[model samples]
Target: MKIGLLPLGRPTFDVPFAEEKLAAMLAALDATGHEIVGPRELLFDEAATRAAMAGLARAGIDQLLILQVTFTDASMAVAAAAGFDQPLSIWAVPEPRLGGRLRLNAFCGLNLASHALGLNGRAFSWLYADPGDDIAGDLKALLAGERPAGRLDAVPVATRSPDGARVAEALRGQKIARIGEHPVGFDTCAYTPEAVQALAGVSVDALALDDLFDTARTVPAEAAAEVRRAAEADVTGLDAVNQEELDRSLRLKAALETIRESGSYNAFAIRCWPETFTQYGGAVCGPTAMLGEGQVPCACEADVYGALTQLVLLEAAQAPVFLTDLVDMDAADNTGVVWHCGQAPISMRDDTAEATATVHTNRKQPLLYQFPLKPGPVTFLRISQAFGAPKMILSFGEMLRRPMAFTGTSGVVRFERPAGAVLADIIACGLEHHMALAYGDHRATLRAVAAELGLPLLEI
Candidate 1:
């Protein structure tokens, strides 16, 4: 079979690591004795991807396999699926838990690609494995036109929480300020205002990313200093990073508070990405953590539904909630690692570790919170659009006492079920990558809330 391989990546991540992994992957594919067509180098943007796809189309490949080399938005994957008629598949490599940086966030790219393709009504197969692993069987299955399908289980019955009515009432008048649009091909962040209103009685207010930047610029030095002083109580090493950038990051907190108070918004969904580091010269992760600790949930990547999910969990748990990604899972240890760049609330920091001001692993901008999560019972929740409709997804787990799995805010969690089973369910269900995590067992309250909202509950 002739296979077309398109390698996608972003410059923000570790390009050297991606190149090494790409070379290994190409060598493994060559061992299969299949005709491999397309560029071996990483395609960093749409133009490169489109140009490569044109060549693959001319080659008349039987399958198109996307080599997700690093954490990239789903635009290129979606475009490839739209342009190609052949069967599609994605292969994302895993990085070791080096306790430093996430060298290649390929799995996250695959997760994003899967969600976008599902939303676009495109069918595809997926594989998460390292190049050195023996994946001949998996490769054969993909060549035989195999695809992963999520199995929907019956909603579980549980006792409703007495606070369900109050939580429902609280959601009625709440509003979320969505600053800027979600990144390209981030279908998981896509949401309909009417649906949100109907289900949660919440309103969404769209704002430009520049508006936040402008407000941040206007923040007086005194106000920023006040924020910095307040941060010193919970955070350490403020002066270790670039002082100018640190001041800029603190100003972002002041600016967000201004917008939140003036707009009467209960939450924020921010496009906290390339611009925050590339254009604004600071990171918003630290500011997001501060606001979240103050009960104003902030979702990254302008994920509106993620903010709403945080709100729901916050109401249910009545505590600080962290929106995180399930980065790594190990069946042998029955543990899965939940992590984010650096936006977890300071209150969730482990007792043994001090919350330190840090830089983004990839972007290298200051003002991100770095610490392991506290060990305790936890509840995971998401307002999911998987399967093309909104539903309630819940999971119960316990954060184990362990060393930090990787850089930024991360925790090792043991779910109610086996790690392998949970991983399989997550992939099969095509769940969104972001999950709202609140420390403590609030499963009952979440169930009651889901019941009150008449949303289907899928507990994995």
Candidate 2:
């Protein structure tokens, strides 16, 4: 792991102590088989700080630790970190002699700098100590790809261009636990147990709807409410439908959290289906949405391959991701309709204002979203295995708002293409007329994962 350290504040008069302290931290890092930077560079100069950050960004440092001394200014450092969007941790050391005036200044400045970083919404962990201890070791563990409790992020798997030998080698040994059965009549999306094993090195675990229901029964009331409030806050402009959606969204969110808490799962695939809607009343729309939003992506139709794709996306971006269905398609104008058992995170709505939640008892979890579809440029991607090969599809376009008469939350997406060639291409790809959609750009990161996996990649 490559970690960068940026110390913001005035220099301590004890240059040798500063040197020793940094060297100690570096030694601890080295013991863990990691690399460190800036133990020797005098970083008090503002330009020097900025240049270091820029260099770290270009060098592709995975984690950052900032040690604040006396200067107390954290704005510039925060700005630079924000630009890179990497994980950050801040450390505030107590003055060597707290009772003395100069010592007080060190503590005060360090405290101020950490506070500034927090106000900027930067994700950071703070350490307070006199000098040396297990603090550095603790940081090393955090950087060693540890997954904290209740924290989940998307992980990308590469399958761009594939070699028959590589595909077989990749699928020869892996397991994927799939929850629920596929949607009826949408048999195309469902995966056969053998197909999954042969093509992706995945062992499929089939689960019953009762499994989810049992998990929901044990959810604490408080946790359920918190999930509901968070889901409701994401919607701001719904008139009637929003309330219903919010009610159901909360139920699903709480239930999903409980499921993950009980199970030992690194990644999971789920079928948001008739059972979810018919037995549970509202479709598992909001919960499934939150699964992706929460970083544990659930693919519709019990598609283990799709879930694998979602997991890969989670690792690649570490942001809120969405798994959707290509319910309808319109090539006449290069447009398509994306909907499924609506389980995407409300936060991923992309709406500036809030919308109300609506509950529909007919489906799973009953939560229905009641906000305008975020209108803007967006990219769509789908990663799947075909004939023992990993495949990907990438496209971009605009999300159109539903008409006043449309029911539930629905929208049309118009993609740019040659006037008449769109439909043929879509069909040729054997895409299920339905696909997964995620917001924002992920080309570079996606490519990197693909490179690491030694697979084929296609960007359209």
Candidate 3:
């Protein structure tokens, strides 16, 4: 058998020992008759994993052997192995605790990788043993086509709620205006529009960013003024932006409103990135917030699935959904920061002096929002469809008032469980970074939503 051998490690561990582990595993595998092809160097981070995976892919190895020499973030492992359709085996090195700091969280890391792979509908076999002492039994079974048994089938239809029939019916006719494709190399932003349509009764329509920009530029000055006046009362970072930049922002919102009207679009997934900042000279985050207040969700990064998730929470809670990245976690306090590049809406902002208009921190351009979100009970709901099945990830937490951790809007969330547990689930499951956050404890409703959609709701 032609085996693609990926010896994995982490910079957090001893790199030299990891390298030794890789060399030893290669020698043992070579002596067993299978032809091995892969990077001679150990994969210690994202760049190495990408380059190595590409090379192994080109080599056309029949099966993948991910030999974990030490603990690495689950993201690193999935980064290289995301699209691998071949049989996979993860050989985790048993850690010998030498009475110091934990040398390697090998099993924990492997556990995470497995959950992430499961999210993508890839089942993998795992062995916690010394690669140097492996018998032929396990290898033989794999050779004879014994595949990993963890099938990420749809989650059982959840117990129907009092509003179950109505919610499902409403979700069935949902439509999202996708304004552009995902940004370059953002694998998490990738989704199968068709699969979402088939599984959740959601349809994504292709729309052009340029068209929105054009319409926005032509919008009447008075209309833009109304938006600016409202922004002035609550937005804070306007001093950094020019009048023209602010005007462009209002125009963009006008343009989006026009598009929403023309297409009867119920929601939006926008490509708010280099183009929004470079060409338009503004960010769409504040406008997205405005739309959310009006019950029209706009997910940044043109993440269609994210928009869909927002729509789910919006309708269910009758409140705004803030799409954000789980940027930081305070293990001691069991809290994490939910943040995005100022894309959150004003309604979600905390009632503090910081609430108001903003510019892009790095670009120093006008039109992004700046504020911290209000502290309250919040629920997280997000989804991804890879390997042809949609998987849902969710959790609940209390939003805390914390200083701005990054540019734009942010919220400090204290999970129901410890931050470490939540972090582990997120890392191990390889869940997408963006989640639709809404205030209030709606676990029951979200659970019903998952059951109605027939997608597995894997809580973080």
At residue 203, give the lDDT of candidate 1.
Answer: 97
Candidate 2: clashing residue pairs, number: 53
The alpha-carbon lDDT assigned to residue 143 of candidate 2 equals 66
Clashing pairs for model 1 are 150-428, 270-302
- lDDT for 262 in candidate 1 is 98
Better of 1 and 2 by lDDT: 1
Top candidate when judged by lDDT against the true structure: 1
The models' CA-based lDDT, in order, is: 0.88, 0.53, 0.72
Residue 202's lDDT in candidate 3: 83
Q: Report the lDDT tens digits of candidate 2 across residue range 101-143.
A: 1221333333333334433444455444444655555555456
State in Å the error of residue 330, model 2.
4.0
Candidate 1 ranges with C-alpha deviation above 4 Å: 150-160
True-structure lDDT of candidate 3: 0.72
